[model samples]
Target: MNIKYILLPLVACSAVALAADPPVEEYVYGMRLDIDKVVAISEPDELYAPCRVVSAQMTYEDSAGQLRTLEYLRLSSVCSDIEGSL
Candidate 1:
């Protein structure tokens, strides 16, 4: 049996597996959200879908010492909305 023959197939299989993953949809970009007493920065290029797909919920603490929840649609990829402070 020739080892070379098996090598080609292995490389092709690896490539297919990598492509199977879905790309990121929604991105938090440069904005921050407050959750229920916990604040977390969203990952760069993080994929997410609003109501049409999976919703991203944020829970963190507020200045008032109360837990708060913010539900919003990620309009980074799907929508063309620019958010930033100049």
Candidate 2:
């Protein structure tokens, strides 16, 4: 008949579920990526600051069907119509 006791387990379970994803790894040049299927990817906000460097994440499955997460830096903008290019 205690509310806190019941809620504690629920909160703990939810946190574990949310953290079940694999940790992100920094991408390095010459690193072999055996991506077989892409599950999700972060999209940079190019409109905010076009040429700024931003962090990005990608979740995918490798050749052996193991889920993997990778984090890397990328340009905020990919468009060629910026001031310099214009």
Candidate 3:
């Protein structure tokens, strides 16, 4: 006899379910990144030997069904003898 009461509860329940966290599989899938194919370009310099990326790791996510990649770089400088990530 009261459609509004039924519809309101249904809408509230749907909203709660949608606000919950995603499944473990989906979370892992979105956070997975493949770094096996990443290669750093090396530059040769006479004076400092050029600062270059020694290693790289990428984290990828499927946001709204689109692939997005984030790169983390570990750089090495021959002149200052410094190694760090960026």
lDDT for each of the candidates?
A: 0.50, 0.82, 0.47
lDDT of 3 by residue, 1-86 (tens): 88998899999999988765333222232555443432333333335557665433333335344333343445554534544332
TM-score for each candidate, following the candidate numbering: 0.28, 0.67, 0.26
Error of 3 at 2 (Å): 1.9
Tens digit of lDDT per residue, candidate 2, span 1-86? 99999999999999998777887899998899999999998957566555667788999999998889999877655543475677
Please give the TM-score that candidate 3 achieves against the real structure: 0.26
Model 1, 1-86: lDDT tens per residue? 89879998999999998765333334355656443356543322534533133355445566676545444454443233222321
Q: Residue 7: error of model 2 in Å?
A: 5.0
Model 1 stretches with alpha carbons more than 4 Å out = 29-86
For model 3, the superposed segments whose C-alpha errors exceed 4 Å read 23-86
Inter-residue clash pairs, candidate 3: none
Worst 10 residues of 1 by lDDT: 77-86
Residue 57 miss distance in model 2 (angstroms): 1.0
Name the lDDT value of residue 6 in candidate 2: 98
